[model samples]
Target: MIIFGTSSSTIHPAKLDGGCCPFCKTKNQMWIQGYRKYFHVFWIPFFPLWKKIYSVCSHCKGVFEKKEFKDQELTTSFEYFENNKIKIPWYHFTGIILVLLLIMLISILPFLTK
Candidate 1:
């Protein structure tokens, strides 16, 4: 049986003072974070897929998504973090590495047989 699945983890975390939380109306309490999803085989991440941007209000425990960011300051901070901080980790390519090793072995087997 082949074990394959998807998983997500927090890749970035930062405090945003750009806008007040819509729910709590509190400034400097919103946290910007990034979550990355990856495909995995047997619990080992194989490759990365989509990234999700989220903000949470610590004062009221409210959550927001990328589309919900309305304030210009909030949006700017989010874009900067996404563009500069978020990156696919190296471990996510385990599947590709395994496949390449398998291919190499197969190629070498033919030479060894002769």
Candidate 2:
């Protein structure tokens, strides 16, 4: 049986403002959102299979992808999070680290027999 490895979803708050909902025409109700889909083992993400950017309408509950945003500001604002806060973490390498430790232990085992 597979003891590890899974997929996870995360949502991040965006640092954007001054956007209106195109559907409800409500001002200051739109917000930028970041999404990621990644593979993980031992609860640590290995790598993100896909990344997505979106703008959601708070009042209308509308979801808009990058190209779906009708407002130019919303499209441009999505670029702000590209390298800011949405980057993958280095701790996602826990699985790799475990493998390396096992390799090192095997390599040193012969020396311990001396």
Candidate 3:
């Protein structure tokens, strides 16, 4: 069976200063991260979907969704990270190449057999 799933990569850490982490109560110790959804077959990520944002408490290691951060500073930080974030090419539509190659092989198979 083909495995379908999503994956995550560290787009950015807590490089810039920010507010405190609610869970750990540590000032300026929150990290902004993201999870990029992808489709996988045979455990290989093929196609990517939308990405989601999260806040990680550096001290307590508590994870919070984007909506969970109600603080103004934290909200602004999140928006800043998102705006400056860069998109990697390999993280997108990885399965399209495989699909196209398969199609080409299938179309040529009958001709080869004849």
Candidate 4:
């Protein structure tokens, strides 16, 4: 049996300077957290699939998805996260890198003999 599935990790959270939470009407209390989702085998990440961002209202302790955020400032803040928080960790491609090295070594081994 092969163990494979998907998992997500939280990216650095970003704070909105002038945004207000639609739920609590709190200004500058809204923050967004990004999750990097990837397919994994035996807990080793293969490659990233997609990213999801959610908003948290610090005052009200409410967590909401992109569709739930109706405030304009929060909407633009979500866009900022979608565009900027996409730094892929090197470990996410460990399987690919290992496979590539193996292929290269296999191809070069025969050439090196006699």
Candidate 5:
């Protein structure tokens, strides 16, 4: 999920422009690690999984948590069409085809041996 706001000096700006904080405006990149909580017993063994968030800033040197960064709206106004355009690359399709062919060959080989 993404959030966007603009910087303003008034009590409340309808939108946020871009707040300037020492760390928010820094020019550095770092990884922020967070934890994922499991609420059910189905995931008892891996109760907590570490999640890594990649981030880059222009002003701060240390890593910032997800809450620290202000969200920005993507201003792209393009209409998306729902045509049957292949999103995956050709190599990915080839890889999947190869895996399926190998599995089929393996199954047939066992039948032939009997």
Candidate 6:
């Protein structure tokens, strides 16, 4: 995410002291994994809109919007493995190809039928 404008600062869980929860202030704090700030853009039929926002405290297994709390902090994490890998199923590609073929067929059906 892009952090624009002034007063934009990123804080991490490690940097935070043993303080109360920014949300509940109940001292139930957890580690923050990653954080980012950006504008969430939405396209409307006649207008384009955007909301400047921040995402924080994702590592605690809880998602919170920046507006939900005060004194927002940013965090990040990195994990590496020797044999880590990600796989994409063949059926997923096949499904996409099938959808494209169907759309093409529909678009040309009128011409073919004539």
By TM-score, who's the top model here?
Answer: 4
All predictions: root-mean-square deviation over Cα? Answer: 2.6, 3.0, 4.2, 1.7, 15.8, 13.2
Clash pairs, candidate 3, are 46-95
lDDT of 6 by residue, 1-114 (tens): 543232212333332323334555444353433322222222111111232233333234444543444443322211111012212223324434566788999999999999
Tell me how many clashing residue pairs each candidate has.
Answer: 0, 0, 1, 0, 14, 1
Least well predicted 10-residue stretch by lDDT in candidate 2: 1-10
User: Relative to the true structure, how large is the alpha-carbon lDDT of every model?
Assistant: 0.82, 0.69, 0.72, 0.82, 0.32, 0.36
Tens-digit lDDT string for candidate 3 (20-97): 776666888888776676777765668777777778887898988767776778778777877776465484566778
Q: Write the per-residue lDDT of candidate 5 for residues 1-114, one digit (tens) a residue.
A: 433222111111022123333365532233222222222222222122232332333346444444555533201100011112112223323434566788999989988999
What is candidate 4's lDDT per residue for 34-86, written digit by digit as tens? 77898898888888888777888889989988788778887887787667765
Off by over 4 Å in 3: 1-16, 86-89, 100-114
Model 1 weakest 10-residue run by lDDT:
16-25
In model 6, which residue pairs have backbone atoms overlapping below 3 Å? 11-74
Please write out the lDDT profile of model 2 over residues 1-114, one tens digit for every residue.
545655756557664666566678787777777666777765766666676767778888888776666767665666665556577655555667777899999999999988
- Regions of model 1 farther than 4 Å from truth: 102-114
lDDT of 6: 0.36
Candidate 4 vs candidate 6: which has greater TM-score? 4
Error at 57, model 2, angstroms:
1.6
CA error at residue 72 for candidate 3, angstroms: 0.9
TM-score-based ranking, best first? 4, 1, 2, 3, 5, 6
TM-score for each of the candidates: 0.78, 0.69, 0.62, 0.85, 0.28, 0.23
Winner by lDDT between candidate 5 and candidate 4: 4
Better of 1 and 2 by TM-score: 1
Using lDDT as the yardstick, the better of models 2 and 6 is 2
